[model samples]
Target: MSKLTFADMQNPLFLHPSDGSSSIQIEKLHGPEDYRSWRRQMEIILTSKRKLGFATATVTRSTEDATLGDQWDSCNNMVIAWIHTNLSPSIKKSVLFFTTAREVWKHLETRFALSNGSRKYKLNKDSYGLKQNSTSVYDYFPTLNVIWEEMDSMNMLPIITTVSDEVKRNLEEVEKRKGESKLFQFLNGLDEVYVPMRSQLLMMNLLPSVETASSVIQQEELQRQLLSNPRHDMEMSAMFSRGQTGGDRVVVCKECGGKVHLSDKCWYVVGFPNGHPNHGRILMKPGSMNQSWSIWNKNNPGNKPKPAGNVAGSASNAVVFSPQQLEQLMQLLPSLSKQPSKASKTDDKLDSHFSGMMSYHNALNNDLGWIIDSGASDHMTPHFQKLIMPTLVTNLTPNIKLPTGDTVAITHM
Candidate 1:
């Protein structure tokens, strides 16, 4: 026979007495939260190797036989090697003096056994408070599972014995109820967008397994995205409504000049100034018309017209201000060139400051109007349509002081 090498001796068939199929790999214990899992894995590995007794049994040095002592030493060394390899470097030094497997195991058990009242209370508190805020089902479920497993390991779940058929049936019923309760709790923690799906899940006679529910919810989420997208909806409508030789195209509206629909339903008919039946002419305010004339003069330097007073015109006719005529008109009104009153200047400053402050402070909703007041006895607004309870005060009301110490008349409240 060929001599057996060290590599051959290291094989599971030779080194371990059990069947060489099942193998255990202990994951590194990061913290107290991971202790229960690590202990369970360690137990499995030790049991498979037939060295579990080393974790609980004590050896008497004086009376122990040489062969038994050697076996105990080998088992202790193996356990130590396994722990050292798996431990995080930061915690490795703390257990260096542990001479036996039993000592190390007991130390770890005492350190993180979850028997302390305060620790148990905290665990319970955290498990109850846990919510799936902003986290996906895949990410959130694992966090809840970890807590549940830890609670189960601590014997937190209620237990019932199955000694008889009736007892077995009761136990099964209890377990099913507990499973359903957990499923509901998981669903409750999800975002409100999943309310419809959650309701459907609750209606089922038999609750689906957590894995099945997760997969179904994910698929439903994908379908919702596909259906909700405007681009996709447009594509589907185009595909279905298309004729063999391309269907009739959309007709542009003559009134509003929009492609959505016909001119009879045009918004411009109701809204635009010139679109109304009685409003045949385009209405232009005096201030806007003056500004337009100023812009026109600036663009065409040769046609520059000096500032002139108001010009009269028919509803349909335009007021033409020739350069020579405008210059002669400007010489007539010297009062128009006078500086604004002190009160008017102050009012303008206050208005700009108040508007800026309101814009800065009001960040929530832009639709709402800001009411700036200092010591006003009554509230007044220019927006007459926005009045909640309109009891028209007299048209000529006394002036009110603004927050900037400027006074402006309140025409209505």
Candidate 2:
């Protein structure tokens, strides 16, 4: 026992628990596997209980004052017992009979902390091998942080009263290199989908920190999620098209031919849904649906629109020339102007070509200009002599109603 200090005498209860209790509690220490973390927990508890001095050897047993010496012995015993109580059964056997709390704590440190090469090597290997394979960036980052924190604790620099400028620069460089290395490790371990993003990151003039890189990576992840959401929605809509309704019946849209919905909700007929890719697309009017479809169908099946007056004969006429020949014939007059001329020809040759073009039309007594508009849907020319070979249509009758309520019957095909 040593002599009691004046400070100890002045403040006799300075080492007493801050919370006014001495029963310190913590999880049982599980040996070298959790020795560092267990030690941290014990230290925090000891500090809070005002018994850190016992473990730190700051309050030695004193005999100058018998009362102080006894107090010291009692507190030391309490500290020793608390450490033993919070250790595993096997660990307690090694340190339970120690004479002082400080000695026991130091012994545990020397035994487990000094020879931690295996733990450091494992931590390095894990950090090197960790990947964001199936895990999200959010989960992968936290997992990496845990491993990094453990490694940081193992490689902590020695604490000094003051660091020199050279030492400070060295430390800063080491930290910078360490942060850059960690960024590479994080970027490299990500799935191949991040290759473009990784290239962008590497191309930057000043590399970002780990935390910043993580934030950017998370942003990219969110963007990918947003982009993929629409495709997933499209797939789900297709699934619904094939899926059954509540009653196990499939409800189809007559207008769009899709299942699970009606014509009123049809995108092709009513309107495209918001956020759908098909904007500025041609849409069908609800009134012009199946009712008038046959008029435009050109197939000319039965059940055509009823005319207002006397019906016409079968109006479906077969052309004398094939579509290809007609197209070629139509190109002749247009190509004459478009064809580049190497030399100008006399007006006599042009006049002969014009004569052959008019030869297709009959020499009628009427002085009306002829219009060969092949693309016209409906023709109402007064001169009926333009028909190459007139034929009477009697099987099908489609009457055309005049503006004055009187209907004109189509007499010829």
Candidate 3:
């Protein structure tokens, strides 16, 4: 039912007392805008009171509880006071709160009784009771109304005479099942359900089949092999060369006899010292250092031929760090433990480095905004991105050859 207006005095829920305190002082307030302002004022007052060492608590209402109304009865005065003081005088208003449910129920029952009987209650009856069916009076009412206007018709006699006891019982059962089934369907759709194993298997069988196909292909290219001819080991080379020209054999590298990059492979194995034992290749096989070097080159294509002139005079050879930069790098010292001995300093040197690193590190810990991630596999930071020409690495050891004496290590914070 729609809410009862104050004019509906019989509505117990909307009751206004006739005597003294029962009368509501409804100092009308504008809508939500004024309500919010009043609420804010109450908060400020409560906060101030709390500051003055007075205890205060805010009792809020759940939707259902508030609708029930009992809690608001005693607080009616406080609500009125709040509305009057906090809201614009033009908008503020007050109303009395009812305390009992009995009054509200009584008013509602009275209002219901006064409503037009024809509108509130629909009357119906069955005619032509042909089969003398037995059903509850409630069940007969709808059938009665369906044929009510036709009651005078001779053909109407058949319907009124005939409902079976079994039919009535069956209808009741069907109605009950319908209600239960609707509930089950609603709840089942909301959550997952376990299926019987056989049912699951049957569902799986009904699904469409999935098909996958695999293929293999082979091809040979021999242009490079045919082009390159050599003289150093003629006879043995002849046997090798003949196999390619006449035999079904397909060779990949005519220059170096390797499958991967021929030009690059030729340079390393023949030109660089590390290959064939005839040359002394000092750098370890391409790994982290080489990857970093390649990445740096890729990022800085313009850095080719020589270092930039602006950086030429600086300790371009030595690593650089500002005092603040040095302080920031110190935190990363803890993470160095993950590196192998070859990649990091000895325990004593690290301890010494920590001692120096921490002194500066601790002083700036609060203000410096730095983090030590010894656990990180590689060093990275926002510090590098911040500079006009950001020095990306700090506390770096330069020309510090590894035991192999070919590659160097640089540390950064």
Candidate 4:
């Protein structure tokens, strides 16, 4: 097969057994189709590299050929003879390359099995001089190995390296273009796959005689063309009531004057109650201590505090309070002269310091802002006890009494 036809040149089934002592073995083929498949397998190996070894033994069907079997007793020698004598080095190279890949596969498989099934793994005396608890072949390493295998199959090591470097660069660019479109990620992925084709397109001449050119146009070029053509990206402006716990936020874009909503990407001001029209206003009771201060301020003339004399004891630097200066200082102390703003009285009552039963339940649900009172046996709130009894966690200790001499024992999970 041509290179393009066999672009995927690696054998899928050629996994070397993970046992260290075992070598690859090819079973005898029966039919023509089976033999052809075997030959293709050999082709895949020898076309890639040279020097493959196998584990095989010959059975003497007759006494006459019994002596011949002795020569083929060594499996490695037998395979080497079969490769160099019967097949070209092209086949040899492919065989050896296939073997190497299999060897790598077996190594990884052994590691994966060990990591998954054993608490401790043994190593050779000089094997990388690794630590006791080094990272295993599983985890993210498996994903990386799949990529490596794909690259090896395609004979695209250079391409893989280039793509990896390019990916890093693209990620940096993405970081630079923070808060840009999520669609940009698709462009980044596309660029990695299209690198070879796009480079070829760049090298070709753009002649006038050419009616149309086969192209590997970049997403950036496409984006630029779209921008020039004035086709806007579709987006929606959603006005959220703003009590959402997540970062699902809508921010106006400075460039297009469009609203872009990002979920879990924005921070919210904590303790700010949602949907409160008078949230910014701090209110006091009509005759409370704070209100009394306000009323005294509005009625009193200016009585600005003067700075104490400096170490030099110069009283000249301290300003002599004029009637107007004193009057303005008096105005500044709104707490002393005027009553608290009458506007806040009609608004909703201020939130209480102590949490209600529902609020405590919410805290438990969120795994935050909950207090496990040590001196309690069974839940105090009847509503909470009913709902949380099924999932509640309790200690071995006996029940304790609260300050009001009530006893309850359970704690929340």
Top candidate, metric lDDT: 2
Task: Flag regions of model 4 displaced more than 4 Å.
Answer: 1-22, 25-37, 43-69, 73-280, 283-413
Error of 4 at 392 (Å): 41
Question: Each candidate: what lDDT?
Answer: 0.61, 0.70, 0.36, 0.35
Compare candidates 1 and 4 on lDDT and give the better one. 1
What is the TM-score of each predicted model, taking all chains together?
0.47, 0.47, 0.15, 0.16
Worst 10 residues of 4 by lDDT: 357-366
The lDDT of model 3 is 0.36
User: Model 2, range 88-206, lDDT digits (tens) per residue?
Assistant: 89988988678998999999998878455888898889998998987899999898888888889788988867889998899899999999989988998888998999999999999
Query: What are the per-residue Cα lDDT tens digits for candidate 1 across 232-268?
Result: 7777666654542256565576654566566676554
Against the true structure, candidate 3 reaches a TM-score of: 0.15
Which ten contiguous residues of candidate 2 have the minimum total lDDT?
Answer: 356-365
Model 3 misplaced regions, further than 4 Å: 1-101, 108-168, 180-413
